[model samples]
Target: MIMRPGHQQLLLPVNPFFLWASLIVALLLNMVPLGRAAWLPDLLALAIVFWSVHQPARIGIGAAFVFGLLMDVHQTALLGQHALSYTTLGFFAIMVHRRLLWYPLVSQALQVLPLFAISHVIEVAIRLVGGGIFPGWQFLIAPVIEATLWPLASLLLLAPQRRAPEPDANRPL
Candidate 1:
């Protein structure tokens, strides 16, 4: 049975269940006990990029807010600390979303790096104001790593599908 073009475009084989599942996996990756710097993956950022570029309507600032809250809660860092920063970051991401969606992998990584830095900056400002100790330049390292990983992350995460277009009655079949 052939699917209509609209139906084909609209169909979601996995629904949101799969999307949330991927996010959960990202959460796990974030919460993993990785003591070393080399092994860390910017799981949450990567997932946000994936969904932002591919499914902005489904995942946006709101989702980022919730996820940030979750990160704050699970990591026991700060309550609204990450949430505010993440929401602000998400706003910019959404603002540049059209460019992000069309950008080549390397370009996307380059652009997103600064955004990752911006997000981190918000947190750092919060920490600084709250009398958190100077974490030194090491704190900058994670977003650098996170930004560097975007190309690979996007490829692995998006997994684009270009299915054949379905029939339309006006065109010859």
Candidate 2:
């Protein structure tokens, strides 16, 4: 479909398999031992939020909860910690999904910042309740990183679904 200037083309329907595959890759990336850089960004959370915003029907709260459970298991943290956080994130994403669709990519990222922060807050609250010590202000860095990476993540994930340009059909003979 041809998109007029200043207007964005609607995204094509995404494959369910591709959606799950991207989540799996994000999970693996999250699992990579980055040592000190472990706080870099939560790729898994980013993927969940991305899909939750763009394709809520396919990746809803239940999916976020499942992925969060998997993350908790992989990290050996409190079993339900990630689950609650992700579910909350998904809720916020769904709430703002339509409004988000109208903004440019950078604006969308900016808009989602609060959702990312809320997810982190949920995780921190869980940790605190479990008698864990404060992880320090540096712990807040992940949300900022995740928000910053939003555009890149959207681009990469949507590349396969983007339509190719049409040939010129109105050219003079």
Candidate 3:
């Protein structure tokens, strides 16, 4: 493949096992007993958005819904609360996936900030509708933190695919 300035090296195909494993790890991170602080980043949501943007075909609204439901069950929140928010997040991510990839990671993070904010708004709105008390202004921090984590997430998640098939001194990928 011919290289263009600013174009990233071509990535190898994503491994299915690695993909699922990343999601599971994110879920486990969420499951940690952190007392559900409003400012805490939603690891599962971050991972979902990451994968939805990078590999839309493999991680779409359906997968988001499933993970959301699991989160609801774990948190004992209203049924479908996380589902609705995560589905919205995944949908928006997929919608912008192609265009988002054209920019540098920092720009991509900026683009995704709104998606994370919207997801949080959806969750808070649902909670409010269900008579839950206001979580205060601190809730606003979650989206920003999630956006800040975007560049790190992209580098980490794509690491496996970025490796050369076989290290060779003679050939540069």
Candidate 4:
């Protein structure tokens, strides 16, 4: 479909099942035992931010909170940390959803940097308040990585929603 002057590409209607399935896959990715690279990008957070921006009605704060809680349980971290982070992230994403939709994927990633950073900051604050030792500057790397991966995540998650190419009406028969 031809996008308007101020708009990004038009996406086909997304299937809710596919949406949730993507989130589940992100959760699974987060759960993988990466050992030293355990501090890698939060795939679930990236997915949440992507969906919240692209399809706010389908994925909102409640979904983020639930997924955060699941991460808490799975990681055995303090309860509600991820929930708070994700809820805040969702709120900001929804706040800018319309504006964000106008940008190309790479630009969207640039715009989303602060939202990802804010979520990481919230998590850090919670850990600090909970008396967890500072995990060092390296702990800050994940948000940057997450932001860097935003475009790829957007492409991956939106692939199914992209409309298939139309047949050329002017083709010579």
Candidate 5:
């Protein structure tokens, strides 16, 4: 692929420990005691999608499913509700990871908007089928928020990898 003039420097190989740690942090964020607000962005979903796109080999559907199950257990919701949502999200993210990386951050977020929306739709459909009440239009706000968060997530999560592995006075990268 042709590089853009301001294309970012080559990133370091992601540390396995940091990769899992970030996922755990995202899970903990979701586990916070805030009341169930339909508009709250799914931080875990954002993290999963980010990693799936940037580090596809490291984080995949299996990790998404495991985290989703953990969320299901934590929130006491339908057993597979989050698992299915995340698995779908991760799958889509992985599918588009290559193409997605070529776009500007803004465009990338726009592209990912649908993935987040679809994941939410799956969750809502499952909830309704499982006899849960509609969460109202506020639920729609989540995907938008998650999409908006894409650039920020990219910045934060990619920070560690962006640094030079070994900064030397003679070499600037």
Candidate 6:
């Protein structure tokens, strides 16, 4: 389980604010309209990866499943589709999270890009197998954007806390 230094005692569930906020952001981004491009920014994918790496127990596969359901509902897409993809992605992220933590920015970005891509690929493959034209290359742009945002994402998740070490107490009763 991932944990923040300041949030050591925070072994409980993920905050509702973070969960819903990520969903709202993903939903809003999904609402964007584009005439020439059929691209989505994969904001929710990044959020799931972020929280999974930084707070695994609080935001694990179950969280991914729930969020995927919400996303599918919001987009009116096929049911159990995003949920299945996200659940699989979440499992992979958790399994390899330790190695991901040891990697630097470029390597980490490289590692993460594929996870995001996997979700899209799974979705696309399912649609194709169901009898549909393959989505264009623009469908691939979101993971690149998501990978580029890793630096900003780290700051967003880590820079807010300023925990100071407490001195040991040995007072006699």
Question: Looking at candidate 3, what is the lDDT of residue 137?
Answer: 85
Model 1, 136-159: lDDT tens digits are 777788777888888777656544
Stretches of candidate 3 off by over 4 Å are: 1-5, 169-173
Give candidate 3's error at residue 128 in angstroms: 0.6
In model 1, what is the error at residue 15, expressed in angstroms? 4.2
Spell out the clash pairs found in candidate 3: none
lDDT of 1 at 170: 70
TM-score, one value per model: 0.78, 0.89, 0.95, 0.88, 0.95, 0.75
lDDT of each: 0.72, 0.86, 0.94, 0.85, 0.95, 0.73
Between prediction 3 and prediction 6, the one with superior TM-score is: 3
lDDT of 2 by residue, 102-160 (tens): 78888988998888888888988998999877778877898989999999998999987
Supply the TM-score for candidate 2. Answer: 0.89
RMSD of each: 6.8, 3.8, 1.7, 3.3, 1.5, 6.4
- Lowest summed lDDT across 10 adjacent residues in model 5 is found at 1-10
Report the candidate with higher lDDT, 2 versus 6: 2
Global CA lDDT of candidate 3, please?
A: 0.94
Q: Which is superior by lDDT, 2 or 3?
A: 3
TM-score of 6: 0.75
Give the winner by TM-score: 4 or 5.
5
Model 5 residue 67 lDDT? 98
lDDT of 5 by residue, 1-173 (tens): 77854676788988999999999999999999999999999999999999999999989999999999999999999999999999999999999999999888999999999999999999999999999999998999999999999999999988888888889998765
Candidate 5's C-alpha runs over 4 A off are 170-173
The CA lDDT at 86 in model 3 is 95
